[model samples]
Target: MKHLTVVDHPLVQHKLSHMRDVQTPSHQFRQLLRETSHLLAYEITRNLKSGTREIDTPMQQMEAPVLTGRRPALVSILRAGNGLLDGVLDLVPMARVGFVGLYRDEETLKPVQYYFKVPEQLDQRQVIVVDPMLATGHSAIATISLLKEAGAKDLRFLCLVAAPDGVAAMQDAHPDVPIVTAALDKGLNENGYIYPGLGDAGDRIFGTD
Candidate 1:
């Protein structure tokens, strides 16, 4: 079974387990999202670009590596994605943040874009698009397509939980952008929600209907 990666870090796994429980409240759920986002941020940015420069340390000059180029732009895919934004920013405080708002229509079952914005000169910056769950994947693909149209060349997608169908959809749609997800669960249920998913991410995070 090609299951999505459930991150091995003890803290990440523990928080995720808590997030999966139905009894978790909105406040704590949001807090968990922030914490997990930071943990995942560590894994995703491990190979980020940096440069070495001479630094003086009391005695003599020493080589030190500092981040190179621009701080990557972090784009959150609307309401649910915002939950991840807090955590990611904690890890990369210098990263510029942007947002794309797209919601799936219950009746049509298609993504609808109500808002979209990205930092200028996205082409020169690496962009990390974030969301808690990769369910149907329409929103992620469409958001990426929009970013591509806006001249974003470098891209990565981050999610906490993903379903097999969504991963396949994203893989087929974007072979260039590698996905970084913590867990790949069984599959999507009939309504296109991930099976055993921590319920609706947006709803859970926002305490909405």
Candidate 2:
């Protein structure tokens, strides 16, 4: 996988347009995100390794392809990551799930970790970190570092939208992890929000804003 992959599939772009709309309601926004996540999941998991297994069919015995390795781990970056997590889980029903809780400090525009939990054998399984937005990348960088400390080696970062600054920061901090996003928007605002991004993904998803 490349350092960055923008999933530009038609359906993903279409749903993202609605998500970016300020007038979109929480219920509708949540539905769109769930739908869009499926598409993004397709791209992010494209390179997973597969092997063949011999099985008997009604007609004859033949080899059938199946995923070969241990189940991949889906690590959600708390709150907003849950929205994407649900959809991805729908697709990969057997995937292991985990969470890292962090909130940005408004004054310093940095992430502060509050909670962390992840499945065991991280070094043996592929870990994909999910979050809705990558505005400053502070939370993502911090979360990935913790995962590494916990023995996670193979990892990926998935998001709905990303700012150049965030992408660059991730690349600089963790060059080995590939980043997969639905869209890379114009950049960050003065307050560190991605410009034209679906504002406060947590708020929009929960109707708190």
- Where is the poorest 10-residue window by lDDT in model 1? 1-10
What TM-score number comes out for model 2?
A: 0.98
Candidate 2 lDDT, 141-204, residue by residue in tens? 9999999999999899999999999999999999999999999999998999999888999999
lDDT of each: 0.87, 0.94
Candidate 1: stretches off by over 4 Å: 1-6
What candidate 2 gets wrong by more than 4 Å, as runs, is none
- Mind sharing the TM-score for model 1? 0.95
Weakest lDDT window of 10 consecutive positions for candidate 2: 1-10
Residues 1-209 of candidate 1 have per-residue lDDT tens digits of 23234567889889999999999999999999899898998877765789999999999999998999888999999999999989899889999899999989987667899998889999989999999999988989999999999999988889999888888888788777767887888888778889887999999899997
lDDT of 1 at 154: 88
Give TM-scores for every candidate, taking all chains together and pairing residue i with residue i.
Answer: 0.95, 0.98
Which residue pairs show backbone clashes in model 2? none
Model 2, residue 199: what's the lDDT? 94
